[model samples]
Target chain A: MTPRSVLVAILAGRPNAGKTSLLMHLTGSPQRPINFAGTSVERVESRVVVEGTELQVVDLPGIGSLSALTRDEQEAIGFLQNRAAQGSERTVLCVVLDAVKLSVELRLLAQLSGLGLPLLVALTKNDVARASGRPVDATELERCLGVPVLEVNALTGAGVAALRQAILRRAETGRPMPLDIDPAAVAARVQPGSAAPARSLTDRIDAVLLHPLLGLPAVGLVLLAVFQLLFTGADPLIKLIEAGQAALAAWTVQQVPAGALQSLLVDGLIKGLGAILAFVPQIVLLMTLVTVLEASGYMARAAFVLDRALSSVGLSGRSFVSLVSSFACAVPGILSTRIIDNERDRLATIAVAPLMSCSARLPVYVLLIGAFFPPRYAALVLLLLYGLGIALAALVAGVLRRTLLRGGHSALLMELPEYQRPSRRVVVGQVWTALREFLVRAGTVIFAASLVVWLLSYYPRPAHIHAHYEARRAEVVAADPTAQKAALLELDRQEQAAYLEQSYLARAGKALQPVFAPAGFDWRITVGILAAFPARELIIPTLGILYSVGEVAADSYELGSLAQPGASGEGLRARLRSAVDAQGRPVFSTLTALALMVFFALCSQCMGTLATIGRETRSLRWPIFTFTYMTALAWVCAVLVFQIGSALGLGPART
Target chain B: MSHQETTLDCLPPGAVASVVRVEGEDQIARRLGDLGFWAGTLVEVVRRAPLGDPTQYGLRGYRLALRRVEARRVVVRPGQVP
Candidate 1:
């Protein structure tokens, strides 16, 4: 094919003009999620080769007549405003207009026309206009706006090539028939010399979404609904996975000989993988809610509602999106810090991100709450944990804002996106992406961690005892006489557990007890915490392994923890539960659970989050600092929680 | 020099100046529409919010937010704010 034109055309448009959607339609790449160099907010850039010309297309953040209401807006305006300063008279300013909403867009057309520069109007959503029976005569619209109007349907990618041809024609020719702009008409709306308009649509949206009287409650209810959906919707999926795990375990035990291989198959792979897999439901549900809210423009509305409060704590209200996601996973939540530009505010945000009580903590909380707190109060207790997390995060942010990272406050200046029903396809797309990412982590990182923990809990059997216990014991022991059989079984159980006592994870847990003894953590709790760092969901499986019940390992550890462990006997299980602590009370008390929750809430425990931070920041310093301080804070908080909780008669007294 | 950072809404309309300095928490100022204090670029105080938190201003044909305390930091020449 012959080259139609070799040219570089910069696609320009006002915001909400379907620039991004069109880019996606054309490029077929997810470049729409690229982060701005300094800002965490993503920018959409698409490259398309049309008839041999590779056009570098940028979806510039919308401009209001090259004027803005915020600093980021100014930066966007600068690129458009810089055409004359660059000593170039031919930067193609392709202003996009919605065919159906011509009146509102015409005002921008008039204002953009005054620049006395090259410009084109790509009339977008032509399909919607046509389907609504509004025939947009391109010539008449062009005459009315005094600019070239090209009809294009972003959904179908039709007329895009024609749009490119128009761009090429304009670029080759200096002035493509200047739009008929009367400065007087445009100047009437703007102040005589300033960009201040009499009123803005954003101001109207703010009146409703950010109203002091109604905004906060509205935001709370929205969040409550999101959490409720997560809890309610994830039930079926979680049950299905749990039932699958049980069936697999039963099948493995029946098929294999009653020996080491059967026990290992049932306990190691199936249990570990199943445990991590269970929480996928919560992650998927939470992400879907966030995607819908964000797409519907409520996320920005939330920023406005929380703007002043966040400013006082040295956080931008924009940080709310990241914090909301932190409720699902703090790892991606921290990586979202690219949105916050200031160093101090970023640090404060990072410190508090773990406080959002992410999904990894959900399974642990659900189990503990279901077991300990009454059903009527379970949700309230859950909310209380979330509330406590929010309060602690705010407190820490306040202190950091005032001290270590004093910052200039941020005022809310965000685009109030026009209200549209969030696309179901988009929400589903986002949820699928998040679920895939979560499973990928579970399969690789969590899978590996589970193996190490299981191994540590397995080997080093006392006095060279090996060759698979059930097999060897059957051959070597005398035929079952009641007294001898009981003695041998007890010896075998003790020897198997002793192997755990001697393993590295066990040794490390034992070594940390003195440090955790004040927090009411025995060696068992320390090992649980250790396993939980790679992922908080692992706490359940870690406990399972510590208790010799680690089924599905830490894989289903979070949401799947309540499943029956293999090789279970009611009497033996209760005996294990009643194991004595150094304080001569039963270990795993209510206070320990409370302390563990606090630690989970306060500590920056996810390795994936740390790795993401390192990737986003392109350095090790911030993530390292983040993980260290949050961990220290977690330890101190956990200790204080236990001490205070015990004194208040919250734990051990229940027995 | 200790730069002045004024809330954006408080700045009177029609004052022209250049952004000479910017100070406040980086993230906060950024959220409130505070770009860096580059050497060149016209800045103008445009409008104040009715609720008196974020004030809007025009700079280089764009409007952005500035809390009351941060607007004073621009340290601009008198001709740009308007």
Candidate 2:
């Protein structure tokens, strides 16, 4: 077998024309659905082998015309211009067209064809068009445009193989060739015949969907359904993932002897990463639902319904999709900001996007609330925390838009593509792509971060400490079988406590304690906060480790009175309830918990989100600005919550 | 009918018009043209947003939403006779 040169096949089309779906079908690559206008802000590449020929498919962002309107369109045009100038024999232009909107696509096709390239047109969505009794005549189109036109259904792989062969043949031809037909004359003959207008089914649907009175309620219901699917539908899958991780951890523990490597794998890497990985199901579900919404044409309608309210806060309607996705996880949410047309609006949206309470924060919030507050109040408290994040985000977005990101004239002129049945294949492809990307991107950062935290909590063990732990274990093993279990647990607790106290994390926490004192946090709370900056979910496992050493067993004591140990002793919650500061006042008071909740809700703690913002902006200025502002806001809000709550004498155990 | 010219935002819902010009001598006009709102194109106000600020309009076989601030920049002549 000989090596083949990579031939660049550029897939260009107007917005929402099934170009991405065609790409997925042609290359068998899982493509993410970005249905709204301007979402394809960058070029994506996929490699495929056809007849032993290597083809590098470059899917340029969708554009309305080669003339260019928004920044995204300009980018696509610029790429084409650059490629055209190179005059490389390796380049092949494949213009994708929506069969139902053939005339509209012809305008762009004509412009692209004028670039003097070996042009081939892929007429997509032929299934939908045929169902509507308006299937495009590929032969007529080819005769008119003087280019090879192939009808393709990306959903079912119809005509896909032939299209691939066509591309291979064109690349082999290896030269730019202008069409023999005149574009102006061809467009004039094919443009939906000016005498009779095509009244699409989309118009009938839009009559109710875009209705002033009915649209709002319908839009709200659609949004509610999406959120319900993301949160409730994904719950069981998340539990299953967590259970799997736990089983893996148990297996690892059974296989390895008690040593540093065992602890590192089981405690540092597994537990730490497992806590973060548990949210993948929710993110995948959100992306799938968003893709479906976009493909069905409702996403644009949703944006139209939301345009007024969003613009009031200095954001365009495009920010609605990105902001809502942030509730699942900020990394994908930040990436979705590509749909926003204006650079200033895009940056502003990215800046305040992380303020949405992500799934990562849910674990920490639930752990703290369940430990401190009653079970009956869980729903209300969770609602309040999410609401607080949203309110602060809106306020911050407004401020940023009026100041740093100011100066651009906001516009909302965007096309609402015709509605069609979302392909099941595309939806599945989207979910798979989102899951894989999240695992590769955010998952690695968290794994490394967990290892660093594990190292901090596991070093500098003195020989005497080891000797003391072994002696205690020996005494427990020799005792009566009835007391052996409890004695062994107590001995483990003592050993863990001693080891933790001498570790570097403890020293760092003690040094940072004074800085967090105003927010009512002690050294232990400070340690959790410091560790959680890399990944918000780390706080829960961090607290579990910290309290397991100093406290008794799990969930064995009452909430308020930590001193009253049950028959099996107390858990981490009881230990937290009974914890004390230097002045002997109990920590984890109701006020302090509220203060910490406020801090986590507002802070830019997730390294994944920051990294995404840097990648999207292609600059560090925005991420730095986001981090600095968010941290400042979090600190100020926490201080206020603590100070005011203390003044009012609130909390379970007031100092 | 009076020979009068008005911005697109002033047209009542359900009214039809033809775009006479895009007012701004800037990229906004060019962008509006690129989005199929060029001069001589037929346009009609389909509906307004719930808050009555951004209105949806049908043009060139598609629907688009334009806030009052942006709509005011497009000059249109009412198709109806007085």
Among these predictions, the greatest DockQ belongs to: 2
Query: What tens-digit string does per-residue lDDT give for candidate 2 at A1-655?
Result: 7987678788998887777777777888655333223333446667788766787777777887666555577778888887777775778899998765554566677678778677799988766666655555678778876677888876677898999889888776656556555432453455443212246678789888877789899988987788777766877777677678878888998999988999899878787778567778889888888888888888888888888888889887888888888889888887777667777888888998999998888766765666666667766877898999989888998998888888887777777877878888767865676676567667777777778878988887767998988987887777775678877877787787778767888889989889888888888888888778678877765676677644223233222222233334335656677777668878788788888988999988877788778777888998898899999998899989998888888854653
lDDT of 1 by residue, A1-655 (tens): 6654434344555555677556655555544334433444444455667656666566665554444543335556565555534533435667787654343455567656666557788888555445444435677656655556788876567887788778766666565444565332332232232222223444466566555477788898998898778867887887788789898988888889965577567656776787567767777777778877877677766765666678777787777877888887765566455445355566678767877887767777765543344456655767778888898888888987888777554434354454556655445645665665556543456666666666666655455655456555665465665556755656566555556667787888899889988888889878878867666766665565456542423233333333343322233234345667656778866567668777877777676666656555558986797788788888998899888888888767534
Q: In model 1, which regions exceed 4 Å deviation?
A: A1-17, A27-161, A164-208, A242-279, A341-343, A373-377, A408-411, A424-463, A467-472, A475-496, A550-577, A581-585, A647-655, B1-52, B55-66, B69-82
Error of 1 at A140 (Å): 10
Best by the TM-score measure: 2
Q: List candidate 2 stretches off by more than 4 Å.
A: A2-6, A29-43, A47-52, A67-75, A125-141, A172-188, A193-198, A467-482, A549-570, A652-655, B1-3, B80-82
Name the TM-score of candidate 2: 0.89
Model 1, docking class? incorrect
Interface RMSD per candidate (angstroms): 8.8, 2.9
Q: What is the lDDT of residue A185 in candidate 1?
A: 37
- The per-residue C-alpha lDDT of model 2 at residue A17 equals 75
